[model samples]
Target: MADVKLDIRPVGAALGAEIRGVDLNHLRDDEFAAIEQAFADHLVVFFPEQDLTPDGHREFAARFGELEVINGLKKLDDQHPEIVVLDDAVTPAADVWHTDVTYRESPPITAILHMVECPPVGGDTMWINLYQAYETLSPPMKEMLEGCTAVHVNRYGAGNHEHPVVRVHPVTGRKSLYVNRIFASHIRQLSRPESRVLLEFLYRWCEQSRFSVRYRWSPGGVGMWDNRCTLHSVVNDWSGSRIIQRITVLGDKPTGLGEPRWPKFEPNANGASDFYDKNYPF
Candidate 1:
């Protein structure tokens, strides 16, 4: 295995580790274990210089968990209908910094994105390490988020869906800061104005520069990241087209999906929750 030399390296502060040994085209079980361990230590892994068809990418990602069916995206291939194909030629949504489809009650566990087409210059993907993002916060801020929950959504304004601010990972059982700029409208169960004040403050910190890492892409490159604990953005400055085939592993409901402070609301309830309505004044 040492002869294979899994040239592991960190790409971004968001905890991306690049792997240079195993080929996804023909992965062995033990080699796969090495990659998974690298993922545990690094949270993200990229395999470069291996040629993969859409089937190859899906096959590799399925080894991790059940494949996710993207609600409104085209399938990569008939045989592998669960894959999501993301390319640079997409609409503006693809460029946004998001933890893929957090609008759902239960989001995906991880995501594997393979860069098939890359730009000549200027086009990189950025990710933020939520685990580190939470650890580095001031004690007061940490306290505020610990007992609080924020709504995440894709509907319009914030979180797009309602969920807690600090959630325990189902796989690792470790708590991570869950809010992101893509959604995270505000903290429900609090007065509208107070919620806004706190939510904005938290969002700013989560978006801080120190928590992120950027990865420049090349063809035949694959990056698999823990979606539950990281937020990623594909830079869209290139004039030319860049295409990437992405696969997601669906996850379960967040550990603290519906707490008294973080009540669950209808999928598209304009930010009002049952707990807030029945208990809070504003």
Candidate 2:
């Protein structure tokens, strides 16, 4: 395939770009480099109107890093475990804002999504830049947060995982607010009441419209985001059916600023139940 100069267009002031003139099915080494750079610069990139087979999707995701085969998801084919199918009829749309798989010790660094079908209107997705979320906080707030850790719990058997309240990006050396409304249960350093209050404030602060970008999906379009420094949620107002396939690239354990204010996290036999007692606001 001949090399075509990538036509990159910024979608929002905070964090998204749409790249035209490149085919995901056949990306050259240099073209892939440009795409990677765009991802790093913008935190999320979208490629519109490209036909990609399951194998091609997996191959493109693998170019970024090692692929993670996720369980408990509907698969496109039993032979292709790496690519999972998401049918809105079967799985309800995710209405809450969240980072992908933060309940794991090593969450995915990047998420690549391929749109198979979508509603004509109202099923857009939005992403927030956590880097901006962290940077905009007052100095005292940053000081208090630098040494904190938070526990994230999944209702499922995946159990609990603890991460820094403020995580430093492995590649960019940038700090980002890592807690979210969905999985993040509480701050490890504070009391239950204090954690709730603080988490609620951070949640509202991080999701301000100034730091987000909303994308409308189209069939055969592809969207990928840096999960390390962003939170995403889907708008649930659409009717009809929506279908997509996803592949994730494995990431390293998150590192935070300075030392943790508390000891390492270890769950007892009671599991996440301890965190889900009557006091849990949700």
Candidate 3:
């Protein structure tokens, strides 16, 4: 298996690759290693024509790390707690840009999504390379964020956590712009007005078209991404139903080269109103 060759093709200049010639359900050690290496190099990797069951999906994701149970409103499979069912009726369209579970002290490091159903049109997912987002920042701007941290609160206002403004990937040892518009409330060291301004700028900067890639979903297509160094959003343009099953790999507490500054917990400031679907579509 170590000698297995994989056909990996880059989908975009900034991020994403299409991986061929490997069946995820029947992966060999070397094949899986190649897939893992491709994921590290290309922030997101797409596998086409992979037919996997719920247990198979969980098995594939567990190879990277321990799997985390699906949280929030999404319902989990009664048999497999790690598998989260994402259907149009059960979950609202995630049109906002975010890294998964950033409100938690330990957000997921990676996520593997298997497309079980596809709409007649639209329903593409987009991903941004946060590493590129950080690298492209002006030197002065980078210096400004040296020791800053931002508050991230879940949409349900259940928990509040703070993560470094710029996170260093534990595996790659490279810096990435970590703050996102979905969960980030405000910067701890800045005034309310200042924090809002800065957060808006950083969010817009990270979402620039040049640093991102769009992936069209297909039946039997699987997408895997490093959540620690990427931001992703689902395009909700499709009218018909779209279905995807996701398994997330639990990550360690985020660490940075600079000392971390925790944000002040404001129980009433969870920003539930800012959620993508104010009606709680999910």
Candidate 4:
């Protein structure tokens, strides 16, 4: 294969980049290496106008790691069991910010999504830099979070898992806030009231506009993000058909700083405390 030069442009101050001058279907080995480097540096990368087939999309994603079928989610088809099709017509769009499948013992390392169809306007996606989220915290807040673990459970009855509130990234050795509103239920080190208050504060802090990048989707545009150090959500502002297909690379169990052992608090029923139900009322 011939050498290819890439034009990488940062889309936000916190965490996103757009790569030009390479096609997903025909990426050279050297180009892929640069792509990998860009992914590590940017946390989330987008490649616009690459019309890739389903098999091509899977092949590109498989290069980063083992592609896993998302638990409690249906696959796009039997031929491509690893792909999850997100069609707005049939599926409920997620507007809440979240890291994918954190309820699992091992959550996804990364996610690659290809927009098969795009609405004429709206339907943009947003990503948060979790590293910045952790870094921006006060010293005391960081110290407190590093010592705590939080519970995450799938809303669809998949499974429950506890991970460090602050997780150190395996590759970069940088720390990130691992909790999200969708799956992360509560912190174990604090009482229910304390946990709820702290978790809510962290949730709001992590989602500030200064730490995010919003991408407007177009047909054949492919976006990928490192799930270990980021949270993402969709803007539910569109009214027409919008479809995306995604493949996720599997990750290992999260390792926390100090691995501090604390008394395990009993998790709320279905990962929802009575307070949450009464107040939130979803």
lDDT digits (tens) for residues 1-282 of candidate 3: 246678989999999999999878888889988887788899999999888877778778989999887566464557888888788987788899999879999998888988888997999999999999999989988877857888888878768788898889887788998899889987876656677789999999999999999988789899999999999998878988798888889998887667754444333366533333333211
Per-residue lDDT tens digits for candidate 1, residues 49-140, read: 88887777878988888887766676777877776677656645356566766777878888888787888886888887788878888898
Winner on lDDT between 2 and 4 is: 2
Score every model by TM-score: 0.83, 0.91, 0.88, 0.90
Residue lDDT tens for model 4, 1-282 = 225557999999999999998889877789998898888889999999998888889889989989887656668788999999888998888899999889999998988999998999999999999999999999998998899999898878888888999999998899999999999887876767788899999999999999999998789999999999999999999988898898989988998997755665544735756553344212
- Give the worst 10-residue stretch by lDDT in candidate 4: 273-282
Question: Sorted on TM-score, highest at the top, how do the candidates line up?
Answer: 2, 4, 3, 1
Q: What is the lDDT of residue 88 in candidate 3?
A: 90
Q: Which of the two candidates, 1 or 2, achieves a greater lDDT against the reference?
A: 2
Give each prediction's root-mean-square deviation over alpha carbons. Answer: 5.2, 4.7, 6.0, 4.6
Better of 3 and 4 by lDDT: 4
- Give the best candidate by TM-score: 2
User: After aligning candidate 2 to the native by TM-score, how far in Å is the CA of 202 from where it should be?
Assistant: 0.2
Task: Write out the backbone clash pairs for model 4.
Answer: none
